[model samples]
Target: METLIVLDLDETLLYAVQNKLERDEDFKMGSYFIYKRPYLDHFLTLLARDFKLAIWSSADDVYVKQLVERIKPAHITFEFVWGRSRTTKKRKSVTDDYYFVKRLSKIKQKGFKLERTLIIDDTAEKSMLNYGNAVQVAEFTGDPVDDELLQLSNYLQTLKDAENVRIIEKRFWRNG
Candidate 1:
C-alpha cells in the first residue's frame, strides 16, 4: 500500500499576505494566500521520497490545484486530490481530523488499510485529535509572514524518519 500525506492550505501551508488578499475583493482577482514559511518545496520533495503527496483542502480541487501551481511549477504534482467535499471551519475546541478522511479514502480506494497516511494541518480538530496519521500544527491566523514557517522544514523532515504509524503517535501525539 502507498503511504499518503494530505496537506492543508490557508494558514497551515500558506500565509495571507499583500493585505489585499485578506480582504474579500482580492480573492476575486485571484490573489490568494502566500507562503510565510520556508523549506516548502524542500520538505515536500523530501517527503515524496517515502510517501505519495496528495492534497486535501476544503477550497475545491480546481482552486487547490491552481494554488499549488503557483508553487509546484513542474517538479511536483499531487497523486490524487480531494477538494470537492463540503467542509466548514470548526470551532477551535473541536477535535476531529478524520472529517475529510472518508472523502480522501474514497478517492484512493485501496489505501485505507495502510495506516501510513498523514494529515498535516494547523488545527487540532482538523487532525481529528491525531487519528490516522494526522499531525496538527498550532494555528496561524494573524498574518502571512509568521515565524513558524522557518521551522516547518525541520519538522516534516523528522516526520519522514518516523515511518511507522505508531512512531508518529509516540513522537508527535504525545500528551501535551
Candidate 2:
C-alpha cells in the first residue's frame, strides 16, 4: 500500500491573508488573498507519484473544498479533502486558547494504518496527540521566494519506502 500523506492547508501548503503581500496573489477567495507556496505544483506532482495524498485543514469546510479545487492540479486526485468540521477542537494548556486538531485516529477509522500515515503541518500544538506521525514544517506566510516545498519533497522521498513511518525521527527531518 502507498503511504498516506495528510497535508495541512493554512500555513503548510498555502498561506491565505486578508491583506495582500508585495508579491502577486495566486487567487482571491471571499475577503482573503491566496498565495501558493513556492514550488507547490511541482511538489504535489512529484509526491503524487509515490504516495497517496489527502487534505485535512482547520479552515472552514466550504472554503477548504473550494480552495483545494482551485489549487489542485487537474491530473492529481486526493484520497480525501476534509475541513474543520472533521477535526477535534481542543484547548491549549499554556494559552488557554481553543484550536483544531487533526487526530490520526480519524484516519485509522477510515482504514489507513498509522504505521504508514504521515501528517505534514506547521503547528505542533494541532498534532500533539500524534507526534510520531507528524512532520513539522516551517510556517509559510506568503514568502514568494521560500523553498521549503522543494526541500520537503526531497526529505519525504527518503521515507517513501519505510515500513513504519511512526518510528522515524522526523523532528530533525530538515537536517536529514
Candidate 3:
C-alpha cells in the first residue's frame, strides 16, 4: 500500500492573507488573498504518483473546502479533505492558549498504518501529539522565490518506499 500523506493548507501549501503582498496575489477568496506556494502543482503531481494524499487544515470547514476546490489539480484526488471541525482543541500548558491539533489516531481508525503515515505541517503545535509522523516545513507567507515544496518533494522521494516512516529522522529533512 502507498504511504498516506496528510497535508496542511494555510502555510504548508499556500499563504492566505487579508492584506496583499508586494507581488500580485494568485487568487482571492472573500476578503483574503491566497498565494500558491512555488511549484505547488508540480509537487502535488509528483507525490500523487507515489502516495495517497489528503488535506487536513485547522481553518474553517467551509473555507477549507472552498480553498481545496480552488487549488487542487483536477487530476489529483485526495483521500479526504478535512478542516477545523476534525481537529481536537487543546490548551497550551505554558501560555494557556487554545489551539487545534490533528491527531493521527483518527487516520489510524480509518485503517491507515501509523508507521506509513505522514503529516506535513508548518506549525509544530498542531502536530505535537505525533512528532514521529510529522514533517515540519517552513511557514509560507507569499515569498515569490520560495522553493520549500521543491526541496520537500526531493526529500519525500527518499521515503516513499520506507518500511516504517515513523522510525526515520525527519527533523533534519531539509538536509536529507
lDDT of 1 by residue, 63-94 (tens): 77676666563667787665646344444345
Residue 103 lDDT (model 1): 35
For model 1 the local lDDT of residue 107 reads 41
* Candidates arranged by lDDT, highest first: 3, 2, 1
lDDT of predicted model 1? 0.57
The weakest ten consecutive residues by lDDT in model 2 span 101-110
lDDT of 2 by residue, 1-176 (tens): 99999999999999999988998899999999999999999999999999999999999999999999999999999999999999999887989999998888988878999999999999998888888899999999998899999999999999999999999999999898
Question: Per-candidate TM vs. native?
Answer: 0.65, 0.97, 0.98
lDDT of each: 0.57, 0.94, 0.95
Q: Residue 162, candidate 1: how far off, in angstroms?
A: 5.5
Show where candidate 2 strays beyond 4 Å: none
Candidate 2 global TM-score: 0.97
Output the better candidate (2/3) by lDDT: 3
